[model samples]
Target chain A: MTDNNSGFSDTKQEIMQATYDAIQQHGYAGLTIQSIADNFGKSKAALHYHYDTKEDILAAFLNYLLSEFRETIQIDEDSSPEQQLLDLVDVLLYGPDNSSSEEIFQMQTALLEIQSQSPHKQLYRDQFTQIYHWLGNLFVEIINNGIAENVFRDVNAHLTAQHLLLIIVGGILNRHTTNSEMSPDQIREIVTAQFLPYLKK
Target chain B: MTDNNSGFSDTKQEIMQATYDAIQQHGYAGLTIQSIADNFGKSKAALHYHYDTKEDILAAFLNYLLSEFRETIQIDEDSSPEQQLLDLVDVLLYGPDNSSSEEIFQMQTALLEIQSQSPHKQLYRDQFTQIYHWLGNLFVEIINNGIAENVFRDVNAHLTAQHLLLIIVGGILNRHTTNSEMSPDQIREIVTAQFLPYLKK
Candidate 1:
């Protein structure tokens, strides 16, 4: 009998969720084993039994995020490639949208800091590279579809998709940190307007 | 007599330059007073005489970068606003190819880290806000010019410029981090191709 002993995977998920919550409230600098354990109603020793250090917890969380993203974008068997690509974008930019935005931002910030000093930085870098390549392939598919449908001009599909993916990510980063009086709706309108013309068929 | 004894203002500039070089070489995690002092051939005490801590050094470097960006994008008195806007985009996306791109990437990464914790994050945020508004104003000028010249379609200039900036930053960042064998030239060509049709006069 153990607090997290339903299963090993269950235990890990519990701790990860707790750590994510703490980070959302207090930022990465506020992430500590004691704080996490306190939030879990356990002692730091119990926390250590499962994960050795703060970095370990962060690595596990990063793995979860990457896996979720990859799974989110994986194509279904019967879906047209265009639909798959749109699904991928929606999953990336508009996930559950319930409890994830601040948590995702905090995780991004924390991982960036970890990547600064740890040998594990390569782990995250590899994850990003995989996502980037996947995005390139998705763009190539969408551009081809648009041209076959005669919605897009005869242009380099690879380059067009790459540029679009960049705008999506970079636009979100800019919008996330911006302090302008622009409402969220306004920002979305701007992003959609910029993106639709390129995506339209 | 003071060591080096360049006037106080020059001394400040020297320290800021040395600090930028040191921090850029060794990221914030490894940055130290000793490392910066060594860069300048001065004692740690001598370096601390100007700035109180490593954070101070980092902040000074950010200020230096902000000023350099401002200078490059400054609107000239004689040029039309349209020309000034075009020049600003050129300066931002394709500045002198002489400098190492790593330095620019490091500066951006460092700013993100420092901003997360610094009280002066607001100051940096304000600078970014100014950049956004300035870009918006430039787009407005372009739209007005195009309308007068009967060249452009009925598009919202401010919104279009905002999106263009997003895609441009995104493409540059993707090129910077990935191993896609894509060059800056290719990225810029794609950008010009996509936006030129929309900007016809």
Candidate 2:
């Protein structure tokens, strides 16, 4: 019984990995159950049994990313706001190197495409809102801590957090679109130098 | 003959304006040369005489924007880097609001649809390169200013500028792709706060 269940779980994982790879190579425009099934040498019915549709697969991918990000970021309740914010930056700018550019690109393109289509639009919206709220709260925590320590200004925390997310996300988006020749380290250095000086110590 | 030529030029401008308006109202999906001519009560042949094809009209619209932006920026040959950078930002962020949501949507959709299509692709690429180069130069100017003034850290100014441009352009692309509830004002505020802090003394 244990062996059978483990084999089933392994197949699901393999299916997901295959889907991610397909998205990376062909983009959202080319992703389909048939393609994924062919990659796995399985029937379309088998792929459907695992994931009802393309949205189901995409949602699973997003959820997997969310989980992975959560695992990467370890928010300590006792850490100072400065430390927390720095940690946040570290996670975003220099977290797991395992994340591929292709995967990120595929995910972004898929999410954008999904947002335009109905039914799935609402689902994407909900997922996006959750991500934003999580990000906003993290900023709020850091800003409040910074304020308490007399290292930050009496400015609006929500606004600051919102802007921080924009900068980081905007930076990633820019990196992909322009094909900027900077290495990842170089990109991080520029961002830190530009952003850190604004921190009122 | 001179008077007649000037009258013809005026009519051409009117037709272009009407074409722009038609694109905004009907979207590129529904936009046609006949419709544009019909909007202005002009013959299709007349429109064709001015613009060889619909693609020509789009190119002209982009050119008009670039030329207007060039005229709007009060360029000083001897201005300091900081001043020039600020001027560049003002130009990019505060240009006359010539773009409506519908028009932008139409242009974006049509462009994406024709992204790989020949002839149109070349036209798009030409305008794209012009904009990219202009943006890149603006960044170089800022970085050079920072070096001369010693206000900025001794960082790779060109790469940094490229990165900054990427973020700005990325944010614009995101707005087009997602059509999220985020307003331009909200985005601009965030970008300004993140970017301006780095430029401070």
The most accurate candidate by lDDT is 1
The regions of model 1 sitting more than 4 angstroms off are A1-8, A36-53, A70-91, A100-120, A135-143, A150-155, A181-184, B1-8, B40-50, B73-90, B101-120, B131-154, B172-183
| Candidate 2 regions with alpha-carbon error over 4 angstroms | A1-18, A39-41, A46-60, A76-87, A90-95, A99-126, A150-155, B1-23, B26-68, B71-129, B139-167, B170-180, B191-194
Candidate 1 A-chain TM-score = 0.65
Task: Provide the TM-score for each candidate, comma-separated.
Answer: 0.73, 0.65
* Candidate 2 C-alpha lDDT tens digits along B41-82: 888998888889988877675555455455555556687665
DockQ values per model: 0.37, 0.22
Please state the interface RMSD for every predicted structure, separated by commas: 4.3, 5.9
lDDT of 1 by residue, B1-201 (tens): 123332336777777777777878886666788888888888999988888877666656665655555444556647654455556666666563456666665664555545434322565555566656666676677666666656666677777776667766666545544455455566566556666555554
lDDT of 1 by residue, A1-201 (tens): 123323337667677767766776666666788878877677899889988877677767666655555544556647664566556666555554454665555555554444333322555455455667876886787668767877666777877777667666556546544566543344456545655565555
Please state the error at residue B149 of candidate 2 in Å.
8.5
Q: Model 2: per-residue lDDT, tens digit, A6-95? A: 223777766766776676666667788877777767898988888887877776655555555555667776877766787786666554
Candidate 2 structure, TM-score to reference: 0.65
The collision pairs in model 2 are none
